[model samples]
Target: MSYCVGVDIGGTNTAIGLLDGERVAAKESIPTLAGEGPDSLFDRIAATVRGLLGRCGVPGDAITVGMGVPGFIDQEGGVALNSTNLRWRDVPVVARMRERLGVPVAIDNDVRMYVYGEALLGAGRGVRHVLGVTVGTGLAAALVSDGRLFYGGGSMAGELGHIPLESIPYRCGCGLTGCLETVASATGIARQARDLVERDGRASVLREWFPGEGMPGLTARDVSRAYDEGDAVAIEVLRRTGEQLGRGLAYAVTMYSPDVVLVGGGAAAAGERLLAPVREAMQRLLISDYWERISVVPAALGDEAGVIGSALYGRDAAAR
Candidate 1:
């Protein structure tokens, strides 16, 4: 059977998988070691792939490899222009992989790969027009329109997280103020919770969760738990974030008019706590005709989306 390998490199963890047709043949995940830098990280990925190939009895010539990584990537040239999370700049990822593995490689933005996974086998299966939104430490989005991923002229078309969010000024990692992610990401939600706790000075329920506290901090999971437990402050944070996400989606709906909007990533783990508010806000903000037409659903592929999508990308590259 023909086989392909997929790698999804994230800020904290890297997931690798092998695919045969539509089934996953093998899968593994490891720490990303962001502090170690790119060369070492790439070496580790190479070693891991070699090990997987050996264990699976897949010959190098029989499989292609694809990698999904964070940040803006020149997929055509196989170069990562800037990955703030990975602290990499102008890294020729695909070239290095090809030199090491002697196998064809495909590379693209991580979120785009997640969307592709949805398009092929998950939430967006059989859907022609889809918008995949990820709300993790950061927010990112991908557009699959008319059965094709739209990479804009500068290869930055699907930067949904960078969409300006009115006048709430705050510098983002991307060097912009008031970007959608400043309010909608997992980091953003925690920051919001911190701000609220500091401002109110009310005995926060989260204090109990932390026990011995240094500085007051709330993780996305903590906020989710607090929301579920009926903490007013946590509920408000998520509600506001959902509103921000809805506003961003409102613009995307106008521009792309996608039929389905798939939400994924860590913050999405809040589930209905996040989605209900987002949907409510979307209904309130969007034009009635459009709001009624679009369906926003959580991504079904979960953590495997990126790896599966990367393998699919490799399959496409091999075909080409």
Candidate 2:
């Protein structure tokens, strides 16, 4: 039977899955080691794919590969134009992978793949218009309108993370000051928590984890754990982060008027802790008619959304 291979490449790891129709037949992950550059990374990825196919007793010729890469992508040319996370610049990803795997390859931005997966099989199932936002190491979003991925003129339509917020003083990796992701993403949340602990010298459980002077290894997960323990600082951190995220999303809602806004990614795992404020802030900013018509919820597919979406999209691309 023909199969599709989906690859979700992130800064820290790459997740790969084998899709047998609508169900994931097999899946695995590998350290991205992105610092070693795309060539080394793709080499490992290709090896992993071969191993998976061998173990699954599938022939190489029977599969088409799809990849969801973070950062800017030239989907038509299969080139990773620029990826701050992966530190890639104008890398011809399709040529490299196709040369190694000898299969048809398709690629797109990772968040777009994620939303596509949700739209087809997860929270967005049967929904006509879906807006998916991911809050993780960084933040991003994608839109599916009428069951189709909407790539605006530049294929950069849903880049909500980079929207500048005047109140946010932090500098973003994109070399911008006060981008929304600098405050609303996982990195943002941890930064905020650390700052609060350091600036105000608040007695927070977070201090236990980040006692030392320089930037601590504190993470959003750490903040979540602290929030669970009823740490005042952690609670305040999530509330502010969610409020910023919600305010950022309000702009998307006003423009897209989606039926639902699906939030996903690592920080989203906080569930209601983060979502409650997101809902509140978004509702407060939007008019009653728009706010009442839209629903904000967590993305149902968890980490598998990107892989599933990329694989299915590759399957379609291969057929075409």
Candidate 3:
């Protein structure tokens, strides 16, 4: 009956949950406010965990904490190697949590924790050789084989989004010009839609949201909704996005040969609107052997995947 805290810390918000075994006993969220530095950020997270623990009626020493974060990580060292979104480098995350929270802490790249979550309890439940893709603000994938998430040398494995594409000159936020994330992620989706709309592909409803040079307010949700209305431009945008995402999946499938590819994150809410194209493109891009066995399904745990996965990972890390 041991309890634990699972933390999913992102650029904008941090999700903290108290779990008893497989169920989330309590959950809460707080802004990361990354510009304030890691100490301040961790301080707020510590406070939030305290609040959740109080609600769960659990004591400090009775539970552990696990965090899923972005960027390169020192899993063994518990330091965030570098996270440009949070402006962090070598931040002593484990040491800080141990001092303030008084519990064992486990940490890894957010997507790794995500796939592990799926491998254990969600879409990939009871399955080995799993691949997970989070297709939201950014794109990332993780590989799990025989119940273990693989972190390649330097903990830099599964960075599928940065796989560059030919002829895409748009400079990615990561300083690359052809990364898959430049066209397949939620940001990429919006960027593509806006670019097309501004380029006179505006016979669609997107023009109401983005008149000439009005890209500031354009978002992927806006585009998806338009696609639901059968707008040709939005359909074209998602078509390209799914095609790119499928291409990325094709490579991962060939390399890892996963049994399932769980597509998670916010944009996944598009469901078949997004995945059908991904499937279609993956079929075209992958070899017949890779295509027939792969099961590309949506992530089942939804928002709680991070929370539950981190908590369970924390519990296991503590035992080790």
Candidate 4:
């Protein structure tokens, strides 16, 4: 049987998987330590993929490779323009990979890859149109229509996180202020929790989680745990978070009117804690005619979404 390889590079971890169709033939994950820069990071990925292929007894000619990276990617050109998380600027990722892996390679924005996995194997299966939203350290979205990902003129079509939030006025890594990213990302939620502590000194489980340590140490998981324990402050933080994300999804719903909207990524781990409010807020923001027509569901593939999607992406590239 033929096989393909998929790699999902995140701020902290890089996941690699070998697939024989939908069955994962082998998998591995390693630290990206992205701060070390792209060359070092790519070196790690190449080594890991080489090992995985060897372990699976797969040849380079029998496998295509696909990769998902954050930030603006010139997928067709095989270049990564600007990946804020990786601190990358105009890097030739695909060309570099071809030099190392000796196989056909395809690349796309991480979130789009996640959504493609969803469209093919998870929540969006059989759906003709899909809107995929990912809430992790950052927020982003991708649109898939008639079973294909959409890239607008600039390959920046789904930058929902950069749009300004009315009340927030903080600078984002993207060099913008008051972005919806400030209120909706995992980092954004932690930032809000920190602001609440500074502004009101209000008592909540978050105070216990942080103590005198201050804001930088706070995390979205900590907030989720605090919320689970019925901390009013954590509850408020997530409520605001879900609502903001819901509004973003609402706008997407109104415009794309997709068959389904799939929510994924780390923050989505909060499950009902995040999705409930998102659904409620989306319903509140959308007109009655549109609210019931659109479906919003959690992404089912979790960490594997990007991997599977990437492999599938590569397979598609080879076909073309």
Best lDDT goes to which candidate? Answer: 2
- lDDT against true structure, model 4: 0.87
- Candidate 3 lDDT by residue in tens digits, 1-320: 38988999989999999988878889998998998888898888899999988877788789989998888889899989998778899998999988998889999888888888888999999888999999888889888888788888888888898999885657988888899989888888888887777766567788876675656878888888999899988999898889888888998898989988889988888788899999999999989988998889999999999888888888888888
Maximum-TM-score candidate: 3
TM-score-superior candidate, 1 or 2: 2
Error of 4 at 202 (Å): 1.3
Candidate 3 regions with alpha-carbon error over 4 angstroms: none
At residue 56, give the lDDT of candidate 4: 81
List model 2 lDDT by residue over 111-158, tens digit each: 999999999899999999999999988899999998778888878788
Backbone N/Cα/C clashes per model: 0, 0, 0, 0
Evaluate model 1: give its lDDT. 0.86
How far residue 278's Cα lies from its native spot in candidate 2, in Å, is 0.5
In model 4, pairs of residues that clash are none
RMSD of each: 1.9, 1.8, 1.5, 1.7
Give the lowest summed-lDDT range of ten residues in model 4.
Answer: 207-216
Q: Rate the local accuracy (lDDT) of all candidates.
A: 0.86, 0.91, 0.87, 0.87
- Model 2 spans with C-alpha error above 4 angstroms: none
